[model samples]
Target chain A: MALFLVNVLDGFVTGLLLFMLCSGLTLIFSMMGVLNFAHASFYMLGAYFAYQISLVTGFWAGLLIAPLIVGVIGALIERYGLRRVHKYGHVPELIFTFGLALLIEETVQFFWGKSQLPFSEPAALDFAAFAIAGNAFPAYKVFMIAVAMGIFLTLLYILTKTRIGMTIQAALSYPETVQNLGHNVPLVFMCVFGVGTAMAGLAGVIAGPVLGVFPGMALQLGSIVFVTIVIGGLGSLWGALVASLIIGWLQTFATAYDITAEQVLTAIGFTKPELIWDHPLQDLWTLTLPQLGPILPYLLMIIVLVLRPQGLMGNRES
Target chain B: MNKFNLMMATALAAGLAAGAAVAQEKVRIAFIDPLSGPFATTGTQGLAIYRHSVKELVNEPGALLDGQAEFEMVPFDNKISAKESLIQLQVAMDQGIRIIAQGASSGVANALTEAVAKHNRRNPDDPVIFLNHSAVDPALTNDKCQFWHFRFDANADIKMDALTDDIAANPDIKKVYVIGQDYSFGKAVAAAAQRFLKEKRPDIEIVGNELHPIGKVKDFTPYARKIVGSGADAVITGNWGGDMVGLGKAVMGAGFDKPIYTYYGATSGITAAFGEEGDGIVKLVGAGQVNPAPTPEAQEFIEAFYVSFPDLDFGQPQMANVAPMLAAAINEVGNATDIKAIAYALEGMEYDSIVTGKTVMRESDHQAIQTVTVQGQTPEAAFEYDKSGRGMVAETVVELASNDAPTTCEMKRP
Candidate 1:
């Protein structure tokens, strides 16, 4: 029972962190329909910037400053980089961002070298938050959960209850109409891109210390973030949230459980093969739940894509 | 008669000129490894070590055969892939490079070894040699071993042979968990730990064993929790890169106060992130870097390496073994072009390194049999440049003979 509860908590923590990254990506996709491929690169910048900031001003100062820096950079890229390429159509825009992502990774490697940096959690949050059945929950992980939740609520508040939020939503749905109504649609798009990237940056700032900050950090988290937002829906924020949570639960629970194919096969009235090595399906038989845990999110993503097609909370009829 | 005599004299003159050119020609060894991507850091450091060794050891007077041969490195970036390594090998050989050097991934090493052997079999006259530096998968020196592939570092099973002794002696460890990256090297480590631990300490119970996907795991908190719940007294892992870093953080974050013995826990920017949390908790088993500088020459090499490349962490001067031995072999045969003599000279060569004292090149399998240094990370100032001041102190140093760990190698030498 205790193990179950901790798994739930752990899953939620991971889920919320994924939401923080996917929310920005989904929002950007909704507004500009650009599907910013370099969105995860911005998150990577946040972690590297935070790591650099933490060296001088400590973790708190890094938390505040790094995301802001990323936001400004995101806005600049949208204005100068993405907007210039926008006239060439969506495919070119995607190719441009993909190229930009590669450029960012190389740039990071050039500056930081290819080794994992010594980015560590702050001394303050470096303790056990609590334990369930002798298994200690890290204070830093709890802190990550709290910060993710805080971002979620703050983002929710700004997007749902405010006049600016309504304008942004209108722009996402009917950009031409919004522009015809004297609203700055392009500016709104840039802001959404900036803000979305900032959220990714913020995730990086917090998650970098724990996730292991290196050039590959972006590559590691990049695909999964896409999967999260996709399984949620391209333009649906709520869909993204649901999808992230699902992936988080799937990954954590899958990793937590230990069951082998051999065990399952034996239980199903099948006798064990004496020459396991000689079996044609030896690799399949050798697989356990832990071995398959990392792939669960992708499996879930595939299932969601096939079944729902539009994603869990996605509103498009197509 | 005059015309025939002139033709014979001209042909003899041409042959003499070619022999002289062969004797004076520079020897080029291609440094093929991951010079790009995530594993580039290790490759870069390795390149630095190779450059330094060639300058300070191999090219220096009395190092090479009458200092006549010029040792040069032909750089090729394999990008950490087996296929890319083979491509690089072909490119290098096409450029007249007769020696191929690479050591990052065992998968790549295996491919290179097989490719070199096949090339040797097909060509025979223009065969290249492979000098392995750091990839330590046991099978490379076992069943998959080739006559052309010579590893300078100790293999996985040899290191495990040294490690399990300490684990057996420590009565505090009642139950141990084996966790590693989901790959050949990791599986080998797990299997080794199980076999060696059982053989050494029959009373000790193995609590858990697992293999996580290599470089895919972002967080290891859940895995750490499972380990804690399993009531494990100690942990053994063969994880490297970000996976290793994340695992270390999770272990410390949950405050799992037990030692984590590892094949690669000593590296990958781990100690820097781990501050006080890592001190004495993490252990490593490898060839060199024991505390209190094994010899004056070893200390000098360490100091000189830092002076040359200040940014890099302290690494094994494993290349010292590679360059000096190759030079010695070439010198023994008095000709760099005599491939047979050079390979034969290296078969049972006994080398004395500044770090490990003496490392033997086994005749049966080409794997180096050296003293394994078991070290642990310490916060105190115990050793020189210990992972940017977070020192990896020596715990135990054990040397084994060439026949200590038997190989499955059926070497078919040329």
Candidate 2:
């Protein structure tokens, strides 16, 4: 039971981490109508930057400084790259970002090589938190959860309460109308893009140690963030939250169980024929969600898309 | 016209004709694999090895090039998808490629096999031969075996059959729990291990078996808990890459305190991930601690690999083991640059390798029969070892079946 609780906490922590990436993605998609495929690339950049910065000025400085650098880089891309490609339409913008994503991944490979970086947990939190049912939950996990949760709450407050947040939200509804109302709509878009990318950078800062800042990590997790937003609802922040949490829990819970597809088939009276019993797929049926957790978001997104195109709490149609 | 002017014009025309023929007759061999995307790292390594083997084959002093002796290697990206591989195969054939090499995963390999077979049935004379080097699925040799396809890598059954004898000898290990990646290679290794273990020691029990997805697994605490609580004396796993590292970290961090037996665990990358914690993890593969040192040819390849990649630690790289095997296979193909001759040459061929004394590819299943090495981490720091992490204080080479197990393949020899 204690193990179960630890897993739940782990799931929640992972979910918030997903939220940090997804929140930025959905907001960017909502405002610009183009899914920034390179958002995860920026996250990867943040992790690498943090690693570099941490080597010089410890984890705390990296935690504070890396995301700002990522935010600035993101704003530059929005202003120059995405803005230039925007003239050709949203599809071209999406394509441009996709190209950007691939470039970023290649650049990362060129910089770091094809090996996992030795990103260690902070020295301060380098111990087990609790031993439950003879398993020690590491303190680093709890710290990650706390920081991710803090970031989420802080971002939520800033989005809902601040003047800048109100303007950005209005710009999302009516970009030209807001411009007519004497507000710089382009600047708002740029800022929102910057903030969204910054959130992903924040996720990288925390997730780097655990995820092991690697070259392919951005490509691995980039599509999942899209899945999270799509499953949550295209432009709904609350939907992203639900989807991310659900995905996190689903992955944690799925891997925890030991069940096989053959069992289900056998229960349904499909006994294995000795001739075909030795087939490779006989073992494939044993796979669970945790086994496929990385792709589960896409599966969920597909299911959600088929059933509810608007998403769980989404008002806008995909 | 004058006799002198006519002779000069004829010679110039003949020279121009020969040059055109040389350019047109160049055989294009398509190299399809996941060249981009997440799994491209492995694909890239495979490509590098392929290039090195080809360079060795072509640049060999007495190597023959047959009638035309010219070729172009055109590589296409399959993105690790079976369907995509099939499409790539079709496109490659459409682009006038009569042969291809690659299959980073079994799914792609199997799909390409079917696609190539379908192409053969439709066009008998213009056949495409696929040389698969990386996909280690046993079923590819068994149920899904194709006449046009030939595998170079040691199959899952060969690897498991090798490890079973050593495991059977260890009476201390009575209970075994299997944990593997949720994929064809992983499942095949686990199932093969289970079958062989049951065959040798009927009394030994498989306590619990679990399959986790590849690349998706992060925190393996729950999986580790299950394995630890199962009271298994030893655990066998077939996980690799980030999943392998993550699982090891989880097992160590959660204090799963059991010796982990693995097919690919004692990997160089695993050492990087777990550091000294990776000590005592046992891995089963063809090449480990290439003792008796290596042949002059093998030493040349090893030295070249190191010189090319100085940043990478030359310790337990799986590529170092697999690359030499691949090179030997290419060598045996013998002046056969096209797929058909290469396939025929590879089947039922034996070669003296640095690691394995006499590795043979069985005629019946086209599966490579070779020795397997059991590697354990050395406690003594700065221990001497071979490239595959064997020859240390604690390492053993175990022999398994000398041929591929009875397969249901009806591949008629051409």
Candidate 3:
């Protein structure tokens, strides 16, 4: 029973992290309609920036300042780099972001080297949060959960209850109509992109210590953010939330329970199994979520695309 | 009639000279790794070793590869992709590189093996010989073993076998928990440990078996919980780099309060991340550190490496040193870079190495029979080892295993 609760909590925490990253991606995709493949790169950059800032001004300063810096950079990229590429159509835009992601990863390697950097836990949150059924959970995890939840709530408030939020929603649905009303649609796009990237950066900062800041962090997490967005429905924040929760929980539960596809097949009374004598494929049965974590979000995205094109709570029918 | 005969003899002599010149030319050796990706550090290290060895062995004053002839270490950055490795290998082959020293990743190694095997079947005389120094997959040297591929490092079985006796003898170890990265190396180590424990000490309860992906794992809290709850006396793990360090820190912070036996052993990579957390952690290691009392050859290698790269610390220097040793072996055996000749020379060849002691590259599997070192970390002293009652000193802990033990290859030596 305790193991089940722990798994649930783990899923919740993981889902919250996914939401933090996917929410920004969804907002940007809604407004721009150009899937930023480099979205996770921004998150990685945020973590690196936070790590640097934390080194000088401490973790608190990093948490506050790094996101703002990331936002500014995101805005700049939209205005200068992305705007030029937008002319080449959606395919070009996607390709540009992919190239940008590759460049960012290389740049990270140049700066940080290929080795995993030492990102220690903050002194204050170094100890255990509390013991549950003789198992101690680290206080840092509790802090991560708090921060993720806080970000989610704040993002929700901004998107729903603010003047900028209304403009963002309008621009996502009908850019021409919003532009006809004399509102600067491009400006909204720039801001949304910046804000979305900033959120990713914030996630990076918070996750840097735990994940161990490296060049590959973005590449590993970037596709998952896309999965989260797809599962949640492209532009719908609520859809993203539902999808993120589902993905996070599904992955955690799947891995924790050790329920494999083969096992499922076997459970459904498939007697006389054809032992394929395949080594590597046979090795796949032993795989779990953490093992499959890098690819899980993509799998979910494909599933969503095929089953429910509109996503969990997606606004658009397509 | 005399003038015609003289002219014909001169033309024949010219043709013979051309053939000799072609035979004397050095064959190219390609080295590929993730020079641009997140795993570029491993690639860079591999590149350095290959480059250094090629330079020392092929381009030196008394060179080996082509008898004072020049050969290049054609390095390409695969960026940690199986597809990219294939592309890079083709590029190397296109550029006339017929020999390769493979990088760290098993995926890359497997890709290269298939590509090379296909190439060799078509042109057997001009074949690509892969000298795998880093990839520790047992299958590479076992069931899926290739004739052209030769592994240099101690495979998973050898390393596991080296430590099993010591672990089995320990009375304090009642229950063992196995945790590894959910990859080839991890699964192999976990499976090997389980098999060995089952066969040797069936009474020793394996309480928990936990695995997380190599780089995908962020928080190790729940996994730690599972381990602590397993009522384990000791933990046997093969987590390397970030995972190893992060888990160590998590284990310490969570207060697991048990002896952890790490598989990567006393590698500098692990220590660089989890400095004090590595304290009291027992690890199976290969190269002895320079700070502790090392062999005379090891001291010489360190000094030479320091002169070449003043910024390099002692721990990483062994990687650099391994290159020169490999070079020296090549020089002693073959005076040509012909893969066949070099391959023949390397078979059943024994060399006194700076890092590994009495290294013997076997004729059968081409697996090197190198001395193994087991060391335990000590707290209070930064990066200091406790070799007292631990039985992990150079004289005490280092064990030399025969090549016949792990290798399945039946050789017909030239």
Candidate 4:
């Protein structure tokens, strides 16, 4: 039971990290009508920026300043780069961000080399907060959960309660109508992009220490961020949250357990076949839980897609 | 005033041209390796070693070749791809470069080896010799050996032979967990470790063996937890790069206090990545040590290299011999451009490496037989300075490798 509880908390922490990235991405997709494929690259920039800042001023200063710097850079790119690409059509806009992602990865490699940096967790949070069943849960993990929760709540309050939130919702469906009502639609888009990227940057700064600050971090987390947004359904922040949590829990739990295909076959009343290597489904028989851990999220995504065309919290269209 | 400056520049250019005209002609070795991309630092480090060797051994008047040969090292970026390496090979051939020095990825090395062997068979008159400095996959020396591909470093099995010998002697490591990247090299390491440990210490139990996809997993926390939970006394891995960093951090973070044995660690930013977490806990098996150099020349080379390239360290000190040996081979053949003769000459060659004393190139498999060291990171106070400002110290140094491993190379020599 203690192990289960620990796993639950771990899954929650991982889920919240994913949510921190997806919430901004879902918002950007809703407002701009073009998928920002470079979203995870923004996450990468956040980590690198924080790492550099931490080197000079320590982790606290990095926490306070890195995302703001990322926000400004993101705003500039949206204003100058993406704004020009927007007029060409969504295809071109998608292509632009895709190209931007590649450019950012190369630029990062050019500067940082292809190695993980020594951007470790602060010394204060280095010890275990608690131990369950003889296994200690790290204090840094508690800190991660706290930050993720804070970001989730702040995002919830802003998107649901604020006047800008209402404006953003209105702009999502009727950009022309919002512009007709005397609001600067282009300014709104730029603000959304900047804020979304800043959110991603915040995720990067905090998670960088835990996830490791490396050139490959972006590539590792890039597709998963998109998967979160997709499986949660586009334009639905609530859906993104749900999908992130589900995928996170699924992955963590899958890794926590040690189930093998042989167990399933035996449970189904099938006799174990000797010389499994000679069997037709040898790979299937040899597969185990830890090996399947990374794939569990995608398996969940497949199930979700087949069951509901719209995600759990996604909108039902005509 | 402008005309005078222009005339002075022209005169300087002419003087250099006249000096070059009187100088000896060169034997070019096309370095078809990564000059840019993720592996650029490694490639550039190798290129530096080659350049240093040329300056000290080949270019100097009283050189190893005795000024009979002036070898030029040309750079070509393979981008660390097999296909790209073949493309660069063609480009090198087009430019009339007959010797290729490449090492970084075993994948790229294999591609270059096969391509060169085919080139030798198809176009014997224009054969290109390959000198591999690193890439330690055993199959390259075993089943997949080629006449043209000669490796300067010992193979994976040889390194494992020394490592398992040391590990078996350590009574503390009764339980070992094996984890590596899910690729050919990683699998080979895992298999080799299991085979070697079973042979050396039959009582040592392999508690767990896991293979994660190369560069795919973000966090290795789950893997670390499993290692910790398994009650394993030690861990062995063949992971490198970001994967190594992530795994090492997670393992150390989880408070798994035992030593983690690795094939590629203690250098290439890993020491930096480990920081204080790896003072003595993370151990590695490799060719040489950076500090406490065995010879004065090597010590001078290390000092000068660090002074010039402060950001990089000589990861594989065996690479120091890459150019020297190539020069010796050219001298042996009495002709620098005689590719086949040079290839044959490289066979069974012996040299006293500054790092490892006596190193031999095995004639049968083209695998260099040399002393290997197992070392761990030490504080900066222990050594003056390393690339990470903290150098490594050797735990075990095998004077001569016990390389009794058999090979399947049935070479049809031309």
Candidate 5:
């Protein structure tokens, strides 16, 4: 039971971190009608920027300034690069972002080199906030949870309660109508893209210390972020949150348990085959839950895609 | 004008002939490893170490026999894929490079060994010799051994033997957990750990054994929780690179204060990532001591290497021996072209390694036998790694004689 609780907390932390990335991605996709392939790269830039800034001005200053820098760069890319490619259609936009991702990764490697940076959690949050089952959950994880929740609530408030949020949503489906009302639709799109990328950057700033900042970090989490947004519903923030948490719990619980196919087979009254090592189904018999932990998210995504083309909370079909 | 043209043609002809002569005296070794992708750091570091080693051990005056031959490493990025490695091997061979050196992945190593073996059988007149520096899968030197391939690093089974011996001496470590990347080398390490521990310390119980995907895991906290829940007193893993660093962080973060035994706990940004947090908790079994140099000459060599590449420590001690040993074989045969003669010369060869003392190339399996040391991170270490202020200090030394494991290789000589 104690172990289960630890898994829950760990899973929550993992889920929130995913949400931090997915939230921005979903917003960009919804507002621009173009899926940004380089969203995770923005997150990576956040970490690297924070690392550099932290070296000079400390972690707090990096946390604030790094995301703003990312936001500015993102706005520039939207204005110059993505805006030009937008006329050619979604495929071109995707191709542009994809190329941008590779370029950013190379640029990062050029600057930081291909090694794990010694970026660690600040000394202030070094101690364990609490312990369960003899396991200490660091205060840094709690901070991550708080930041993610704050972003979620603030995003929810802006989207539902604010006039600018309503205008942004109005522009999403009826850009002509919103532009006729004297609102700069192109500028809105650029700002939304910038803000979306800045959120990803914020995720990276907090995650870099925990994940061990490196050049390959974006690649590691890139596919998974897509999976989360896809499974949650392409443009649904709520879907992103639910799917992220589901993935987090699924992976953590799968790893925590040692359930094997052999046990399941035995429970169903199947006898163990003699010389099982030579059997055709030997691999199946030896397969364990933990071994499948990393692939569980993809498996879930496949199941969701097959059953419901639209995500659980998403209104539109992907 | 006609006289000037004739003089230029003669000069060009003479220069071409001299260039051909110099090229003949140069032996080029194709370094097939990942130069891009996530594992690029390890590969790049290995290449740098090899280049530096050649500069000091083979290129320096009186290093090789008569200094008649110069060794060069021509790099071909395999992208850490077996298929790509095979392609690189073909490209290297096409360039008339006879010697192949690689060691980042055992899967890649296995592919190259098979490819080299087939290439040798089909093209005996033009064969390639593989020089493995750091891939430690036991099968490469055991059932899957090839006469054309040579391993400089100790195999997984031997390192496990040394590790298990250290664990056996510690009475407090009764319950142990084994985790590794789900691959040939990782499986070999886990299997060896289980077998060696059972043989040496029968009373110890293996509480948990798990295999996670190599380089795919983003968070190891769940795995760490499992270990903590398993009630294991100690943990053993053969993880390296980012995986090692991630595991170390998760384990330490989870508050499992017990010692974690590893095959590669130090170097490659791992030591730096762990920093003061891993001091006294993380331990590694490897070839030679790093903090306190094995010999005075090795100390000088390490110091010089640091001066050249300040960010990198002299991590792979086996790399220091690769060029010198290859040069010895080349000089003995008086030529680098005869692959068979060089193979025979390298067989049963004994050389004094500045880093690991006396080392022997075992004739039966073409595996190098050298002293192994079990070290732990400490601030008292003579040399700090990655500016971490903590370095690996040797806690125990297992000499070359006792560090031998029986090989199942059946040599098929040409």
Candidate 6:
């Protein structure tokens, strides 16, 4: 039971972190109808920016300032780069973002070099928040959970209870109508893209200390971010959240267990092979849940895609 | 004016001839490893180490075979892929680079070994020799061993032999959790750990064994939790690069205060990431000790290496021996162009390693047999790694007089 509780807490932390990256990506997709391939790159930039800032102003100041810098950069990219590419259609927009992602990764490597930076959590939050059955959960993870929940709530409030939020939503559905009503639709798109990237940057800031701050970090989480939104349903915020949580739990539980194919096969009335090591299916026979942990998310994504093409909460068919 | 013009043309021709002769005296080594990808950090560090080692030990004046030949390292980015490595191998061969040096991934190493062997078989006159510095898959020197391949680093089996000896001596370690990346090298480490531990400490139980995908895991909290929950006295893993750092951080973060034994828990940002948390709990099993500075010469080499590449740790101490050993073989053979003669000279060669003392290249398998040390992270380490005050200090040293395991290699000597 204690182990289960710890797994739940760990999974929750992982899920919330994923949601932080997915929320922004889902928002940008909804508004622009273009999946921002560089969304994770923005997250990486956030971490690198914060690491650099933290060197001078400390982690707290970096936490506040880094996301803003990333937001402005994202806004500019959307205005100067994506806006120009938007006319050539979705494929071009995607290619542009893909190129941007590559460029961002290279730029990061050029500056930071190719090594894991010693971006540790603050000393204040270094202690264990709580211990369950000898397993101590650090205060930093709790902080991450808090920050993610705070962003989700704030984003929910602004989108549902505010005028700008309504305008942005209206622009997404009917840009011509919104533009005719005297609102700058392009400006709205730019803001959404900026805000979305900023959120990803925020995730980077928090996740950097835990997940590590390195050049490959963006690539590490890049595909997973896409998978989360896709599993949750494209352009659906709620879907992203749901999918993120599901993946989090799925991976965590899978890793926590030690169930092997041998055990399953034995239970299913299959006898063990005489020369197991020499057997062709030895790899399959020895396969364990923990070994399969990393691929569990992709497996779930495939299952979701096969069963529900539109995603759990997404409106779009894609 | 006619006499001056004639003199100028003669001088230019003489200079061109001298340049060609100098170029002929240069020995080129193609360094094939990941230079652009997730594993680039490790590969880049490796390249830096090789470049620095060659500059200090082979290329510098009064260095090994200093006047005989100038050694140059030509880097080729393999992107850590086997196909790309083979392609790089072909490019290097085309460029007249007879010496191929690589070590990052065992899979790539296997491919290069096969390709080089095939190339040597087909083109015996222009045979290439592979100098492996760090890839530790035992199969590379065992069933898959090639005459052209010489491994400078201790293979997985030997390292595990040294590691299990340390574990056997520790009475407190009754149970161990063995984990590694899901690959050939990782599997070898796990299997070796299991085999060696069972042989050394019969009473000790392997509580858990698992393999996570290499470079794919971002968060290891769940894995750490499982390890802690397993009630293991110690943890053993063969993970390297970011995986090493991540696993170290996660295990330590999860409050598993027990020691986590690893094949590569130091250097390349791992030591820095572990920082104060790893203090005494993170133990690494490998050749070459940096903390206490194994020898005075090694200490000097370490200082010089830092001067050249201040950002990189002298991670691969075996790299210090590679160029010098190769130079010794070349000098014994009397020329760099005679690949076969150099290969024969390198076999059963004895070289005094500055870090690990006297080391031998086994005649049968070409695996380096040297002093393997199991070091622990300590703040008192003389040479701090990755700018982290804490560094690896030698806790246990195993001086092997011969290969730990009998060779399965059947060398086809030409």
- lDDT score for residue B58 of model 1: 78
- Between 2 and 3, whose DockQ is larger? 3
lDDT of 2 by residue, B77-100 (tens): 999888888788889878877777
Q: Model 1, stretches more than 4 Å misplaced?
A: B1-25, B381-387
Which lDDT tens digits does candidate 4 get at residues A107-173?
9888877766778778888888986665667898899889888887887898789998888788888
Off by over 4 Å in 5: B1-24, B401-404
Clashing pairs in 3: A47-A204, A232-A239, B65-B336, B65-B337
- DockQ for each model: 0.72, 0.30, 0.34, 0.51, 0.73, 0.74
| Candidate 4 vs 5: which has more lDDT | 5
Docking class of 6: medium
Q: Between 3 and 6, whose DockQ is larger?
A: 6
Candidate lDDT values, in order: 0.84, 0.71, 0.70, 0.82, 0.90, 0.90
Please give the range of 10 consecutive residues that has the lowest summed lDDT in model 2 chain A: A282-291
Best-to-worst ranking by TM-score: 5, 6, 1, 4, 3, 2
Q: On residues B1-414, what C-alpha lDDT tens digit does candidate 5 reach at each position?
A: 999999999999999999987853677889999998778878888888898899988887556657777888899999999999999999998899989999998999999999999999999988889999988888898899989999998888888888888999999999999999998878888889999999999999999888998889999999998888888999999998888888989999988888999998887778888888999999998887776888888888888888888877777888878999999998889877888899999999999999877889999999999988888899898777777888999898887834357889998999
* Better candidate number, 3 or 4, judged by DockQ: 4
Cα displacement (Å) at residue B301, model 6:
1.7
Q: lDDT tens string, model 3, A140-248?
A: 8799899888888888898889987788788878889999999999888899899999999988888877666767678767767777887888888888778888877
Q: Write the per-residue lDDT of candidate 6 for residues B281-366, one digit (tens) a residue.
A: 99999887776888888888888888888877878777778888999999888888889999999999999888877899999899
In model 5, residue pairs whose N, Cα or C atoms come closer than 3 Å (at least 3 residues apart or on different chains), thus clashing, are none
Global Cα lDDT for candidate 6: 0.90
User: Compared with the true structure, what per-residue lDDT tens digits does model 3 show for residues B73-114?
Assistant: 677888878898889888888887766777477878878887
What lDDT is reached at residue B8 by model 4? 100
Against the true structure, what is every candidate's RMSD? Answer: 4.9, 6.4, 6.8, 3.6, 2.5, 2.3
Tell me the docking grade of candidate 3: acceptable
- Score candidate 3 by lDDT: 0.70
Assess the local accuracy of residue B116 in candidate 3 as a C-alpha lDDT between 0 and 100. 76
Task: Write down the lDDT that model 1 would get.
Answer: 0.84
